[model samples]
Target: MLSKRIISCLDVRNGKLAKSVKFVDTIDIGDPVVQAKKYYEEGLDELVFYDITASSDKRDIMLDVVSSVAEQVFIPFSVGGGLRTVEDCSRVLLAGAEKINVNSAAVRRPELIREAADAFGSQAVVLSMDVLRVEPRPGLENGYEIVIEGGRRRMGIDAIEWAKRGEELGAGELVINSIDADGTKEGYELTLTRMISEAVSIPIIASGGGGTPEHLYDVLTEGKADAALVASMLHYDEYSIDEIKDYLIGRGLKIRKA
Candidate 1:
């Protein structure tokens, strides 16, 4: 089996690292560059830097911050938010991000995914979906709807269908971010994770609600996720990358050693 990945997430808003609950009530944590360097030195497998407010604020990502983090961390990383076109993807890749993730923009114009894949290869494009669980209704299969613009707007699109479409459009990977489970620290939305993982063959990185090593283990094994995207647990110093990796390794999950 391929080794499961543990990814550290840096959510930036207005040039500072921040964390939020259910995509609101964001609080600034610290400098992203410093944090990125710390994780890199600690031997994180990968990193994901999101310009949190870029989509909601309708502004481009802070390229300077992306460059700073990229320079500090040599491991492969991805950048997301406010990436609306192929030109934007070029700018981010030129700035040193190995992958470009599209959320709000991709939902608005899915061809952007094809365009990005064509220009930079599917491996360079990642489709990020912000999803929330709602009461089961007649038509909203799985009862999860896709939200965009930093979870400020609900697109009313079925989450599973969107994931399959994203893959068809050549997105090499998908980040299934569970808004309700985000920052809760209970665990990943396993049902949602498993459902999507079974639906798409492309690697899916389970994001949100990872609190303990067990949570990571469950997501990768029982939940069938390819990776776990951790934020609060790592951002708040609740655990280090090595600690998490050690636990996963101890639990029989393959992980890269520092």
Candidate 2:
């Protein structure tokens, strides 16, 4: 089996690292560059940097921060937030990110996904979906709906359908971030994770609610995720990348070691 990846996430607000629970009550943590460097030294497989407020705030991502983190981390770096057009994607790539994650903009104009994929290749494009669990309804399927702009707006699009569409539109990978489970750290939304992972052909990175190494194990196995994005567990010094990898390795999961 291919080695499962442990990814560290840096959610930036005004160039500062921040964390939120259920997509609300965000608090500034620390300098993202510092965290990025620390994670790189500790052996993280990949890093995802998101300018969390850029979309709703209607502004550009802090390229300076992106450059700073890029310089500090040698692993695969994925960036999202405030990327609207193919030109914007280019600017981010030129700034140093190995992958560009498109969320709100892509939902607003899915053609942007194809355009970005064509311009930078599908491997360079990642479609990030901010999803929430809602009551089952006629227009929505599986009780999972698409929420955007920091989970402030409900797009009314079905999560699974969107994931499939994103893959068909040429996204090389998908970051399925569960808003309800985000920062709770109890566990990943395994039912939702498994559903989307099975629906798509590309790799799925399970995000939100990862509090322990066991959570990572569950997501990669039962959830069928290719990678797990961790924030709160690592952000609060609750766990280290090496420690988590060791746990997964002991649990019989093939994990990339530091």
Candidate 3:
């Protein structure tokens, strides 16, 4: 079995690292470059840098920050936000991001996924989906809807269907973030994560609502996620990468030991 990966997420807004509860009530955490270096030193499997407000604000990603963080961290790093075209992906890659994550852009123009895969290879393309459970309307086939623009815009797209489509479009991985549970620490939305995981062949990185070491294990074991992405808990010093990895390993989950 492949060892489950524990990834640290840095949500960069206006060049600063920030965290929020349910995607609101934002609070500045620290500097992205410094934090990225710290996580790399602490032996994190991978680091995810997201320009959280770029899509909503309709601005490009912070290339300077990206370049700095990329220089500091030797592990794989994935960057996202405000990437609208192949050129945008090229710029991010040139900025030293090993992988480029696309959410709104891919949803708005799915062909961009193919374009990126063709230009940069599928392994360099990550499809990020911000999903929320909406009230079941009478005619809706799926219970969940995909929201874009930093979860500010509701597109009425089904989450499971979108994951399958992204995989078909040559997306190397799927980032399933549950907006309803984000930063709540209640645990991951296991049902929704399992749906997407089962629907897609590519690896799925489950994000949002990871409040404790047990929460991380729950998603990786019970939720059947290939990897787990966490922010708030780690940012606030609630847990360390080694601590979480130890806890998961103790619980019989296969994890990479640093």
Candidate 4:
């Protein structure tokens, strides 16, 4: 099997790293730059920096923060939140971000994905999906739907169809973030992750609800995810990147040495 990645996630709100449970009750954590440096030194595979309020606030991403974090981490990291146009994508990439993720904006205008891919290659564009389990639609293949704008609005878009469409629109990767599972820390929404993974040919990074090494294993293996995006587990200092990598390796999962 290919080596599964362990990506550290930093959700920035008001220029500080924060954590939220089910998209509410957010708590400030720390400076993202500091955390990024710490995780980089610990040998994290990659990092995902998100301006949590950028989309809802209707403003550009914190490019200064993105640049700071990029300077600290040598590993390829992705930046998301509030990125709309190809110009926005260019700005983030120029700020040292390896990949630009479009969530709400992409849902609103899918051509942005194609434009970004055409301007900066498919590998440089990421489709960051904020998904939630909803009432089953009669014609939909899955019970899940796509939610955007910091999980405050329901798009009524079928998650399965959206994933397929994202790939077709030139998104090189998909970050499947489960809103219901966010900050729960019990485990991931494995069924939801698996559903999207099976529907897309691109790599899928399972995000939200990662609290333990066992949870990571389940999502990466049984859930068929290409990578596991972790927030609470690493942010709270419950485990280090080395520890998570060691645990996964001990469990026979092919992981990059930390």
Candidate 5:
């Protein structure tokens, strides 16, 4: 079995890294370039940098910051936020992102997914879904809607169906971020994560609410996730990357131990 990956996320806003609960109540953390360097030195499997407000604010991702961090980190890095056009995708790729994550833009123009995959191959594109469970609309049976626009807009789309569609559209992987569970550290949304994992052949990275090493264990072992994306725990110094890897290794999960 391939070793499960421990990825540290850097949420950048105005060139500064930040974190929030359920995608709101934002607090500044620090410079993303510094944080990226720190995680790389800590021996993390990969790094994810999100221009957290870019999509919602309708602006381009910070290329200067992206370039700076990309220059510093040796590990594979994935970048997201406000990437809407083929040119937008190319700019970031040239700036040094190994993979480009598209969220609201993809939903708005799924052709962008196909275009990106055609231009850069599916392996270079990651479709990120910021999902929240909402009451089924009138005339619909019991079901939840997939919210978008950084979790602020309701799209009336089913989350499971969306994942399937993303796979069909040639998305190499999916990052399912649970808005309800984000930053709570309670745990990942296992049911949703498992459902998406089983529904799609591509790897799924489970995000949100990972507060403990056990949370990571449960998500990989039971939730059926390919990897776990952690932010607050690692950012606050609650746990080190080596410590998390050791715990997963002790639990019989495959992980690279340094």
Candidate 6:
């Protein structure tokens, strides 16, 4: 099996590392730059950074902070939030992020995804979807829908169809953030994740509700995700990257060793 990636996520709000439960009740945590460096040194496989409020606030990401965090880690770094156009993505890549994720902007104009993929190879373009479980509809036969503006706006787009559309539009990967699971640390929405992962040909990174090593394993194996985007458990230092990796290894999962 290809080694599963253990990615640490740093959600920022107004230039400070923050945490949120169900996409609300956000709280400042610490300096993201410090945490980025710390996690890289500890052998993290990858790191994802998000200007969580940028989409809601309708502003660009803080390049200074993105640059600062990029400077701290040499691993694969991805950034998102307030990134709308190809130029915005270019600025971020130039600022040092390896990948640029588009959410609200891409949904507003899907051409942006194709444009970005054309400008900077598809490998650099990530489609991040915030999903919420809802009643089934014609297009959303799965009962899962897409939400934007940090879970404040319901897009009415079906998650499965959206994933396929993102791949067709040249998105290299998909990060599915379950609104109900966000910050819950209970466990991931495995059925939601597995459905999307199987629906798309690209890799799927399961986000939200990651509380323990077992949760990570479940999402990667049974959930059929290619990676696990972790925040709370790591943000509070509840478990070290190495500790998590060791547990996955013991459970017989092929993981990129920390």
Best by lDDT: 2
How accurate locally is residue 48 in candidate 2, as Cα lDDT from 0 to 100? Answer: 93
**If scored against the real structure, what TM-score would every candidate get?**
0.95, 0.95, 0.94, 0.95, 0.94, 0.95
Poorest 10 consecutive residues by lDDT, candidate 6? 53-62
Clashing pairs in 4: none
Q: Positional deviation of 205 in candidate 1, in angstroms?
A: 0.2
> Which tens-of-lDDT digit does each residue in 1-258 have in candidate 3?
789999988988888988767665788988989999988898889988888664444444478888887777899998988888999889889999999999998999999999999999999999999998988675347789999866899998888888998999999999999998887889999989988888888999999899889988888877889999988778988888889999999999888876
lDDT of 6 by residue, 85-176 (tens): 89889988999999999999998899999999999999999999999999897877899999998889998899889999999999999999
Q: After superposition, how far is residue 155 of candidate 2 from its true place, in Å?
A: 1.7
1-258: candidate 1 lDDT, tens digit per residue: 578988988888888888777776888889988989998999888999888764544434478887887777889999987888899899889989999999999999999999999999999999999998988676576799999877889888999999999999999999999989888899998989999999999999999899999999999998999999998898888998888999999988899987
Query: How many residue pairs in model 4 have overlapping backbones?
Result: 0
Q: Give lDDT per model, in order.
A: 0.89, 0.90, 0.87, 0.88, 0.86, 0.89
Distance from true location, Cα of 111 in model 4, Å:
0.9
Better of 2 and 6 by lDDT: 2
Model 5 lDDT vs. the true structure? Answer: 0.86
How large is the C-alpha RMSD of every model relative to the true structure? 1.8, 1.7, 2.0, 1.8, 2.2, 1.8
Q: Of the candidates numbered 1 and 3, which has the greater lDDT value?
A: 1
Candidate 1's displacement at residue 249, Å, is 0.9
CA displacement after TM-score superposition, residue 141 of candidate 4 (Å): 3.7
Clashes of each: 0, 0, 0, 0, 0, 0
Q: Please write out the lDDT profile of model 5 over residues 1-258, one tens digit for every residue.
A: 688988888888877889877776889978889989988998898888888664444334478887887888898888888888988889888899899999999988888998999999999999999888666666322254577776899787888888888888889999999988987899998988998899899999999999999999999979999999999999999999988999999989999764
